[model samples]
Structures are given as C-alpha cells and as structure tokens.
Target: MIKILLVGCNGKMGTMISTVAQNSTTLTIAAGFDSKTEGNFNYPVYDSLTNVKENVDVVLDFSRPATLDSICEFVLNRKIPVVFCTTGYSAEQLNKIQGLSAEVPVFHSANMSIGINIVNNILKTISNTLYKDFDIEIIEKHHNQKVDAPSGTALLLANTIKDSIEAETEFNYGREGIAKREHKEIGIHAIRGGNIIGDHEVIFAGKGEVIEIKHSAISREVFAVGALKACEYVYDKTPGMYSMDNVVNDTIKF
Candidate 1:
C-alpha cells in the first residue's frame, strides 16, 4: 500500500481524499499537515511538516501556495514523491517547483479532474480545426471562497487552445466599455458565487453556427480522486516533473 502524507488534510478536499482512500485497496493515509489540525482524522494531523515523522511514500498536496516552501523542503529532504494540486502559484514558486523535480518526483497541475484533461485534448483538436473560421471565448465559474479568478483549468484550456492554432493568439480577460472582440484574441471570463464546484464553457462562434464545449464538476470528489490517482502514479517513480496528462495517457498505470 502507498502511504500518503496529505497536505491540507482538514479542508474539504483533504477530507474527501481521506474518504475516497478508505475504500481503496492500495492506499492509506500516513499522516497530514494543516494549519487547523483539530479535525478528527484517521491519521495524525500536525500544524506543520517540520515535526513530521511519518513513513510516507508520497505526498498529496492541496494546500495554499503559502505552504509550498515547507512542502518542498519536506519532499526534498525525504526524497519522497509529491503531487501538488494547488493552483494560483506565482511564477517564482512554479520555477521552484520545477527545480524540486530535479531532486524528487513532482506532479503538478492546474486542475486534477480526469474529465478536464480529456476536455483539454478535445479543445486542442477543436482549436486546430476551427482556427480559421471561429472566434473563441472561455467562461469559468467557481465558489465565492476561491481566491483565484479565471480558474487554473480555464487557463490550461486557454493555453491549449492558443498553442493548437498556427497564428498568434492573445488572451483577453474580459470585455469592458467600448471593447470589441479581436480576431486573434481569446476572451476569458470568470464568475464567482455560491458553492459551484466548478464550471467551464468554451464557445466557438462561426458565421452561422456556434459550438460550445463545456465541463461541469458537480462535486469536489472528482479532484480528490484525481489527486489520489496521481499519488499512485508517482509513488515509485524516478525524479521528474509530471502532469495529469501523464496519468490520462496511462503512462504509469498498468
């Protein structure tokens, strides 16, 4: 069994991971790291990773960007693999994460849902085929408690859409007064309210036809399950950086 040191173990996603792992035959929660360690967990929860002594095979991180430094330190020191599922990291932090991969395995993604990664591939094909005839816009929705706008998955999809086309593609966050859509720009809009797990819609507008590709996450369980799959994939791997695309392609799955 793979023993996981779960970061953000007291949050909704953390609890969900624990819940999912309980039914798995090859996974176990070794321990957890969280600021709020008061929750009743099957494994011990510590306020920090500095004092952790668990025999963990891998780490599953869903914590804030603020906790990244300590998480990196722990993984580097222990030479353990890690799956970082948190988004909204600054460019410098992302560089640090890539650097850490040189020493230990690191799996990071903007979003961890398997369906979203499938949608990523779908957008690539659609963008390549529709580039000459369609104008594209992306709309994303998330819970009000979420701090980042444009949800990382939206950016992931936007970048895939941008790179698939031969011509230059620019990103427009949203339209304002007197602003009109440009031929080479992809518009991204964000909406926040209520308890939306997540929602993303990609609209392709053509002369007389419009196509919308959408993915809606009904619950946080999808992300949690994806992270668990990443944990399994990275558990015994060599040092390298990985993404959900690797898991989707069955690179590590037997």
Candidate 2:
C-alpha cells in the first residue's frame, strides 16, 4: 500500500481524497499536514510537516501556494515523491517546483481530472486542424470561493492550443470595448458562482459553423482519484517532473 502524507487534510479536496483513499485497497493516509488541526481524520493531523512522524511513501498536496516552501523543504529532506494538486502558483514558485524535481519525483497538474487531460490532447488536434478558419475562445466556470481567475485548466488548454499553432498567438481574457476579434488571439473568459465543481468549454467559430468541445466535472472525487493515480505512478520513479499527461499515457499503454 502507498502511505500518503496528505497536506491540507481539512479542506474539501483533502477530505475527498481521504474518503477515496479509505475505499481503495492499495492506498492509505499515513498522516496529514494542515493549519487547521481539529478535523476528525482517521490518521493523525499535524500543523506542519516538520512534526509528522509517519513513514510516508509519497506526499499528496492540496494546500495553497503559500505552503510551497515547507513542502519543498520536506521533499528535499526526506527525498520522497510528491503529487501537487493545488493551483494558483506564481511563476517563481513554479520554478521552485521544477527545481525540486531534479532531486525527487514531482507530479504537478493544473487540473488533476484525467478527463481534462484527455480534452487537452484533443484540443491540440482541433487547434492544429481548424485554426486558420476558426476563431478560438475558452470559457471556464468554478466555485465562487476559488481565488484564481480563468482557471489553470483554462490556461493550460489555451496554452496547448496556442503552442500547437505556429503563429504569434496571444490570450485575450474577456473582451472589452468594440474591437474586432483577431484570428491570432485566443479569448478566455471566467465565470464564478454557486458550487460548480468545474466546467470548461472551447469554441471553434467559423463563418457558418461552430464546433464546441466541453468537459464538466460533476464532483471533486474525479480529482481525488486522479491524484491517487498520480501518486501510484511516481511512487518508485526516479527524480523528475511529471504531469497528468504522463499518467494518462502510461495508462493508455497498459
């Protein structure tokens, strides 16, 4: 069994992961690190990683970006693999994560849902085939409590679409004024309301035809499950950076 040191064990995603892991035959929550330590968890919860005493196989993090430093420190000290499920990290913080991969396996993804990763692959094909004739726009929706705008998954899709096409493409987040839509621009829009698990829609607009590709996450369990799969993928791997694409590709081959 993979013994996971779960960060942010009191949050919604953390609790969901704990519940999912409990049902799995090959996964167990060894311990948890969270600022709020009053939650009734099956495993022990500590306010910080430095206080953890469990023999953990991997660290699965769903905490905020503010916790990156401590997580990195723990990884460096313990030389263990980690799967980061949190979003909204700054470019500098991302560089820190990349650096950590050189010493320990690191799995990071903007959105951990396998379905989103599949959609990402499909968008590459669609963007390459239809960019000349169609204008692309991405709309993403999430819960109101979410702090990030345009969602990282939306940006991931936008970047995937942009990179696939060989042109000077730029992102336009929510148009304004009366400017004509440029063929070289990818429009991104964000919607926040209620308790939306997640929703993303990509539109390819032509003169008379509009082709839309969409993915809707019905529950947080999808991400919790995906994170566990990522943990299993990197449990014994060498030090390196990994993503959901790697996980999906490996599963496809199996």
Candidate 3:
C-alpha cells in the first residue's frame, strides 16, 4: 500500500481524499495535518507538517499558499516526496517549489482534473501553431469563497500557451476604464458566485472562425481524485519538479 500523508486533511479536499483512501486497496491515508479540523478523523492531525511522525511514501497537499513555505521546509528536511494540489502561488513561491525539486520529487497542478490536463496540451498546441494569427483569451468561474481571482489554472494555461508560442502575449485581467482589446494581449476573466466548482473556457479568436475550448468541473471529487492519481504517479519518481502535463504526457510515471 502507498502511505500518503495528507496535508489540509480536514478541508474539503482532505475529507474527500480520506473518503477515497478508505475504499482503495492500494492506498493508505496514514496521517493528516490541518488547522481547520482536528481530531475529527481516526488519524492524527497536526497543525504543521513538522509534527507528522509517520514514514510516508508520499504526501498529498491541498492546502493554501500561506502554508507552502513551511510545508516545503519540512518535506525537504524529511526527504519526503510531495504532490501539490494547491493554487495561488506567486512567481517567487513557484521558484521556491522549483528549488525544492532538486532534493525531492514535487508534483504540482493548477486544476487536478485529467480533462483539464488534456485541455492544457490542446492550448499549447493551438498556441504554438497559430498564436500569431489568432488572439487568446481565458475566462474562469469559481465559488464565491475562492480568494484568488483569475484562478491559477487560468494563469498556468496562459503561461503554457505563451511559452509554446513564445509570442510575449500580454495578460489583461478584468478590464476597467474603457479598456479595449489588443491583438498582442490575452484577456482573462474571473467569475465568482454560489456553489460553482470550476468552469474554464479558452477562446482563440481568428479572422474567419473563432475556436473555443472549455472544461467544466461540477464536483470537488474531480480534484480530490486527481490529486490521488498524482500521488500514485509521483510516488517513486526521480527527484525533480513536475506538473500535471508531466502526468498527461506520461513523462512522469510510476
């Protein structure tokens, strides 16, 4: 069985992962760490990863950005493999994760859905092939409780597209004061409302035909289950940084 130390185990994802682990013969949800809900599960829950005593095969993270530094510190010191499912990281924070990759396996994804991974690749291919001829735009919708606007998935998708095209596409989020569209700019829209899980649409505007792609997630289980899939994939990977694309492309496999 793969021993999984789940961070943020009391959050929505934590609860879902715990429930999934219970039914899986190949996985064991060994321990958890969360400030929000403690002592609610049979496993021990600490406020930080430092207090975790189990020798886990891998760690599944679904926490916020605020806890990233501490989690990295603990995981690096312990030489533990990690699968990161959290979002809302700055470039510097991302660099920190990159730095940790030199010592331990680290897997990160903006949207854990396998379908979104396919969408990301499609965006990359389309951008590489026709970025100069078409304009790129991304719009995302989330629940009202999500603190970050323009969800991280949108940024990751935009960045992947930009890198693939190498077109230096400028990003514009939420227009204001009579702003107009620019061919060289990519517009990103964020919508927040009641109970929505996640919805993302990517539009490629061309002269004759406007091609659009979309991915909709109606349940948190999509994310939770995907995180588990990541855990299984990255369990014995070589020490390095990896993304959902790695999983989708079969570049990082168990």
* The candidate that achieves the highest lDDT relative to the unseen native structure: 2
lDDT of candidate model 1 versus the reference: 0.92
Reference-based lDDT, residue 134, model 1: 92
Instruction: Evaluate residue 45 in candidate 3 and report its C-alpha lDDT on the 0 to 100 scale.
Output: 79
TM-score on alpha carbons, each prediction: 0.97, 0.98, 0.93
Residue-wise C-alpha lDDT for candidate 1, range 1-254, written one tens digit per residue: 99999999999999999999999999999899999999878899999799888899999999899999999899888999999999899999999999999999999999999989988878877797897899999999999999888888999999999999999989999988999778899999999999999999999999999999999999899998899999999998999999999988774232
Task: List model 2 lDDT by residue over 125-237, tens digit each.
Answer: 67888998999999999999999997999999999999999878999999778979888899999999999999999999999999999999999999999999999999999
Look at candidate 2 and tell me the lDDT of residue 114. Answer: 93
In model 2, residue pairs whose N, Cα or C atoms come closer than 3 Å (at least 3 residues apart or on different chains), thus clashing, are none
Decide which is better by TM-score, 1 or 2: 2
Error of 3 at 139 (Å): 0.5
Stretches > 4 Å off in candidate 2: none
lDDT of 1 at 120: 88
